[model samples]
Target: MEVKLHDIGEGMTEGDIISYLVKEGDRVSVDQPLVEVQTEKMVAELTSPANGTVKEILIDVGKTITVGTTILTIASEQGADPAPAKEETAATVAPAAPSQKSMIMERPKGAPLSNRVKAAPYTRKVAREHDVDITLVEGTGRAGRITVEDVLRYVEERDNGKTKAAAAPEKTPSVEKEPVHQPEEEFDTIPFKGRRKQIAMKMSQSLFTIPHVCHYEEIDMTELLDFRKELKAMDENISVAAFFIKALAIALKEYPVFNAKLDEENEVIRLEKSVHMGIAADAEEGLIVPVVRDADKKSLRAIHQEMKELTQKAKENKLTVKEITGSTFTISNVGPMGSIGATPIINYPETGLMAFHKTKKMPVVNEHDEIVIRSMMNVTMTFDHRVADGGTAIAFTNRFKSLIENPKKLMLELV
Candidate 1:
C-alpha cells in the first residue's frame, strides 16, 4: 500500500517532510504514527493505515511534497506468509504490455528512505563502538563529515528537543530513535517555507486584499484590575483576557458590522451571529490563533478556562483544524508581551481585530477634575474600511471601553 500525503485542512496543498517516525524495515501497527510532516498551519503526524513493514520511504527530510504524492510504501503483514519462497506471478515481475510499462516508467518513485552516509575511519569506529546508526546521523563536520561529537550528542539528545522524532516513543516499533530535525548548526541561508512562510502569505493577502483603517483608544484599566483583585481575594479566579473576550463578544453583538466579512464576490457584508473569538498566541513556531468558540454565550470562568486550555494547546502545536478555524473575530493581547501599541492586521475574512498594549499606572483626571493614578492601556482596533466606517469603529470601541471600564456593567452584560 502506498502512503500519500493527505490534506489536513484550510486547502493545504503541500507539506514539508519533517521526519520519518518509523524507519524503513520497521513494523508499524494501524494508526501508529508513520511520519511527521510540517504543514502550513501546524506540524502533523501521518499514521499507518494498516499493520505492515515500512518497505520504502520515498521522500527525505526537508523535502516539500504535494497532496496525493506517495511518500511511503508499506508491505502489509496481515494474512500473508511469514516465510516467503512465495511464488511471484508474471504480473508481479513486470508489465504485460508496452503501454503499461511506459505508464510505470512515467511515475516517479521517490528515493528510498535508506541513504548512504560518509564518515572518517575514526568517526566510523566511534559510531560502531557506540552502536549508533551512522546512516541516520547527519554530519556537521567539514564536507558533511559524520564526526564523533555529532554521534555522541545525537545519543545524548535522542530524547530532548523532540520536534521531529519525539512524537514516537521507544514502545512504538516504528520509531528508530533518530534525533528530530534540529537546526543545530548556523546557516547563511534558511529554507523559507514553514510557519514563517505561512505568516508571510496570509499577511500579504490580508494587506493587499483589505483596506485597513486603524482606530486607537486608551482605556482606564483601574476598575477592571480592582475588580479582578477583589475576585482573587474572594477565591473567584478569572483572567483579564477572558473578560476582554467576553466584552468583545458583547460589543460584537452590538456592533454586528465589525463581526462580519465583506464578501466582495457576493457584493454583500455577511454579519455572523455566533461569536467565535480567535485568541492570537505566540507559540514556539510563530503566531497562532486558537478560536474560543461561542465566546458570547460563555461566562467569565468558562472563557478563562477554555482560553487557558487553548493557549496551552497552541503553544504545544496540538490544536486541531476545527479549534483554529471559523473565527468571526480576533484579538491579540500583547499587553503581557509588553507591546505599547501596534496596528495589528485583521485576521483575513474577519472585519476587525483588537490588540491590547501594555498597561501601566498613569496620572489621569477623575470626574471631579483631580489627578489620580490609573492603570491605562492602549488599544488599536483595525477594521476593513469597505465593511465599516470610522464612526462605527469608534462606537464599537467606545462600547468595549465602557464595558471594560465598568466591570459591574460588563458583568451585567454577560449575565
Candidate 2:
C-alpha cells in the first residue's frame, strides 16, 4: 500500500515533512503515527493506513511536498509483497539498520530533482567548519544525500587515522598566536514561512481581490456597562466580547448580506444562515481565527464559554482544523488590547469583519441635548463594497449598536 500525504483540512495544497516517526522495515499498526507534518496552519501527525511493515521511505525530512505525493510504501500483513527496489549504486545506503531498502528523493509526478547538490547548504557548512572537503564526503541520507551527521562522522574518522603515523617524525611546536576577535552580528533573522507567511498571503489576496470600504460608528456602552456591573455584583462575569458576538449574531439575522460569500466564479453572493463567528486571536505563532460555530443558535453563556476555550486553544497552538475554519463572518475585539480604531481586512470569501475598539468615558451629546459623560466605544465595520453598500453597513452598525446599547433588547432576541 502506498501511503501518500492526504489533504487533512482547509484545502491545504502542501505540507512540510517535519520528521518521520517510523523508518523503513519498522512494523506499524493501522492509525499509528508515521510522520509529523506541518501544514500552513497547524502541525498534525499523519497515521499509517494499514497494518503493515514500512517498505520504502521516499521523501527526506524538512522538505515541503504537495498533496497526493507518495511519501512511502508499505507491505501489508495480508501477504502483500513490497514493491521492487531500485538497484543499489555505489552511492546508495540502507534506509535503516535492518532494511535493505534505500530512499528515493523526487518531486511529484516522478520528476527527478536536480543532481547538482551533493548536500544541502547546512550540510556543506558543517563540512567547511571542520576544514573538510564536502565533495570528498560520502552521502548516507535519502537518495545518497549527505547530512550533517555524515560530515561529522567523516571528520572524526579522518582525525583518528591511527594514533601512530607509521614512524613519521613529529614536527616542532609553533609559537601560540593571539586569538582573533570578530564582532558579533547585530541582526537576527526570523523564518517567514509558516503561520506568518500564511497570514501575509491570505491578507494580500483578500485586500487585492475585494474592494474594501470601512465604516465607523460610535456606540453608547453606558447602559451595557451598568448592566454588566449589576451582573458582576451577582458574580455573573461574562466577557464583553461575548456580548459583542451575541449582539452581532442578532444583527446578522436581520441583515444576512454581511454573513455571506462572494463567489466570483459563479457570480453569485451566497448568504449563510448559520453565523459562524471567527474570533481574531493573537497566538504565539501569529494571528489565528477560531470559529464559534452556529453563534446564532448558541446562547450567550454557551457562546462565552466556547469562545474562551477556543481562544485558549488558539494561543497554545492546539486548535483543531474544524475550530479554525468555516467562518461566515469575523470579529476582532481589539478593545482589550487598546486599539483605538482599525480597518481590519475581511476574512476572505466572507463579506465582512467587525472590529470593536476601546471603550472609554467620553463626553457626548445625549438625547436630551445635554453633554453627558457616557461610556462610548468605536466600531469599525470592514466589508466588500461589491456585496453591500455603505448605507447597508451603516444600518447594520446602527442595528448592532441599538442591541448593545440596550442589553434588554439583545436579551429579547436570544433564542
Candidate 3:
C-alpha cells in the first residue's frame, strides 16, 4: 500500500516535507506518523495508511510536493519478515512477490482504525527537536498518542536534572577567561517559509492596503482586578484578557463597524454576526492568532478556557486552519511581557485590532478629588480609517473602557 498526501485542509494545495518520521524498513502501525509537512497555514504530520514496514520514502526533506502525490510505500502484511534498513537511498522499491495466501489487511475508506496513536504531526516534531523520546512521554491527546505538551513536560523535568547537576560543587576551580571579539559580523540566513512567510505577506498587505488610524486610551482596571481576584478565589482560572475580550465583544454590538471586514474590492463593510475574537499568541515558530468563535455568547470562564487551549495549541504548532482563521476582531496583549503599549497593525480585512499593555499601579485622582493608587492599563485601537472614522473608534474605546471599569456590565446584555 502507498501512503499519498491527502487533503489536510481547505485551500491547502501543497506542502513542504519538513522531515520523515519513519525511515525505510521501519515498521509502522496503521495511522502512525510517517512524515511531517509544512503547509502555508500549519505544519502537520501525515500518517501511515496501514500496518506495515516502510518500503520507500518518495519525498525528501525541504521538497514541496503537491496533494495526492505518493509520499511513501509500505508492505502492508502483518507479521511479515521485516526488511533490513537500507543504506542506499532510492526513489522506488520493488514490490514483494505475489503469494496466494497473503495476509495483508485492507483498510476501509473513512473507517476509524483502532490501536493507532492519535496525535498531530507537529507534536512529533517537537519531541524530536527537544531530544525527548516520545514513547516514554504519556500523551494527553485523544487516545494514547503523545502530544507536544507531553514532550515539553519531559524536557522540563530533564532540564531540571541538568540544573541540579550544575548546582553541585565542582572539583576543579573556575578559571577566568579574557573576552574575545570578532572583527566581522556573521549571521545565518534562514529562508522565509511556512508561518514566517505567511505572516510577512499578510502584514505587508494589511499595512499597504489599509489606511490605518490609531486611538489610544488608558483604563482604570482596579475594579476589574478586584473582580478577577474574586473569580480566582472561586477557583476559576480566568484571565484579565478574557474580561477584555468579553468587553470588546459587547462593545462591538454597539459599534458593529469594528467587528467587520472591509471588502475594499467591493467597497463595502461586512459585519460579522457572531463575534470570533482572535487572540494574538507568540509561538516558537512565529506569531499566530487562534480565534474563539462566538466569543460574545461565551462566559468569562469559557473564554479563558478556550484561550488557554488555543494558546497551548498555537505554541505547540498544533493549530488547525479553522482555528487560525475567520476572526472578526483581534486582541494583541503584550501585558504579560511587560510592554507599556504598542500600536499594533490591523489583522488583514478586520477593521480593528485592540492592543493591551501591562497593567501597573499608579496614583490618580478619584471622583471625590482624593488621590489614590489604582491598577492602570493602556489600550490602543488601530482601525481602518476608511471603514470607521476617528470619532467612531474613540466611541468604541470609550464603551469598552466603561465596561472594563464597571466590570459587571460585561456580563449584562447590550440592550
Candidate 4:
C-alpha cells in the first residue's frame, strides 16, 4: 500500500521536507523515525507506519510538499513468506531503551504546561544542567514527588558544597542564604511549549544560521520625549512602543534591505512590500513576537488597538497559529522591564531586528559648552551580515533614531 503523509496539525497544510532518514531499499521496522518536516510550529519527525522494507522514496530534500503527499512506499514482508511471518510473531522484540522516556515527555496539546511532569520546572532544569539524573532522586513531597529542595539537596550532597564554599573563604555559605533559592515565588514559570518553543528554535537558528553584526548608537531623545509626553497628555493610552513602531515603519521606507529576507536557495533577495512590524512581549512564558500586518497604513489608534489585542492574546494563549508566523521585520522593547540596552537575537528569515531600551535622563554637553540633562535611549540594531553591510545597517539605525528623536518628522503634515 502507498504510504500517504498527512499534516499533523491544523494550520499546517504543507511543510518543507527537512530530510529523509531512511533511503530506498533500506530495511525499516515499525515506529522508526523515517523523515523530518519543518512546519511553522516545530520540526516534526514522521515515523514508520508499520514493520516493512522500504520500497521507494519520493520527494527531494528542501521540497515543499502538501498534505496527503506520498513521502515513501513500504512493502510489507509479512505476506511474502508465511513461515517468516510466523517466525516474526513468535520472536520476542526487545523493549526499547529505558532511558528514552526520561528524555522525551508528552506535552499536552493547546495548553503547554498542563501535562508535564510534577517536578518544579526549575528543579528539572537544575538537574539537567548539573548532569544529575532526576529519575534517581528520591522524593519527599506528596505523591512520592521530587521537589526543588530535593534537587538542591542532591546537588549539595553530590558536590559536597565544594563549589559553593569555595566561592567565599570567610565562612561556609549559609544554607539559609543559598543564592539559587532566590525569591522565585515572584514569578510563575510557564512551560516552554507551543509558540515559546517556536521562539526558542528561531532564536537559536538565527544565531547559528546567519553572521550577525550588531551596531549600536545613542540618540538624544529630548524633543521626542517632550513630543511623547504631549501626545500622552492628549491621550494617556498612546504608548511609546507604538510611536517607536511608527518611526521604524517610516525608516524602512528609506532602507529597504533592513526589511528584507534572503532566499538563499534561489539566489534571490526578497524585499517585503508591506511592512509587517512585530512587538516583542515577555509573557508568563518567554518572549513572543506578534506581528502587526500592514503597519505602514495603520493610524496610531489602530496600532495601539492591534498591539493591545496581540498582547492580550499572547498572555491568554488565545493567539491563532497565523498570528505567530509571517514577519518582514521585528522589534523588541524592554523599556517596560527597565532594561537600558540589550543585544537581541534577530528573528530568523528577517534580515534585521531592532531593540529599544529604557530612556534615562543624563547630563550632556551640547555643541556649545552648555551642559544639560537630556532624555536618551539606546538603540541596538542587529543585521544579517550576508544581506547588509555595517554601513547600510548603521544608516538604517541612524535614520530610525532621527525619526524617533524628532517625532514630528514621523507626523509629516501630508501623508
- For candidate 3, the TM-score is 0.64
lDDT of 3 by residue, 216-324 (tens): 9999999988988888898875788888898898899889999998775587789989999999899888888899999988888788899999999988888987898
Worst 10 residues of 1 by lDDT: 81-90
Best by TM-score: 2
Candidates' lDDT values, in order? 0.83, 0.83, 0.79, 0.73
Instruction: Supply candidate 4's per-residue lDDT for 257.
Output: 91
Q: Write the per-residue lDDT of candidate 1 for residues 1-415, one digit (tens) a residue.
A: 8888987866465678998888889988999999988886788899999998988787899886667778888889864323323224323554449886676567554322234465555456556756767877877854465655677676666646542355655664575687779778866986677777667656755765689999999999999999999999999999999999999999999999999988776789999989999999999888988999999999999999999999999988998888988899999999998999898999988999999999999999999999999999999999999999999999999999999999999877766
- lDDT per residue for candidate 2 within 279-358, as digits (tens), equals 99988878889999999999878988999899889878888989989999999999998989998999887999999999
RMSD after Cα superposition, model 3: 18.0
lDDT (Cα, tens digit) per residue for candidate 4, span 293-322? 888878877898899999998887556546
Tell me the lDDT of model 2 at 378: 92
Which candidate, 2 or 3, has the higher TM-score? 2
Give the distance in Å from residue 113's predicted Cα in candidate 4 to where it truly belongs. 38
lDDT of model 3 at residue 99? 62
Clashes of 3: 1
Q: How close is candidate 1 to the true structure, as a TM-score?
A: 0.70
Worst 10 residues of 3 by lDDT: 84-93
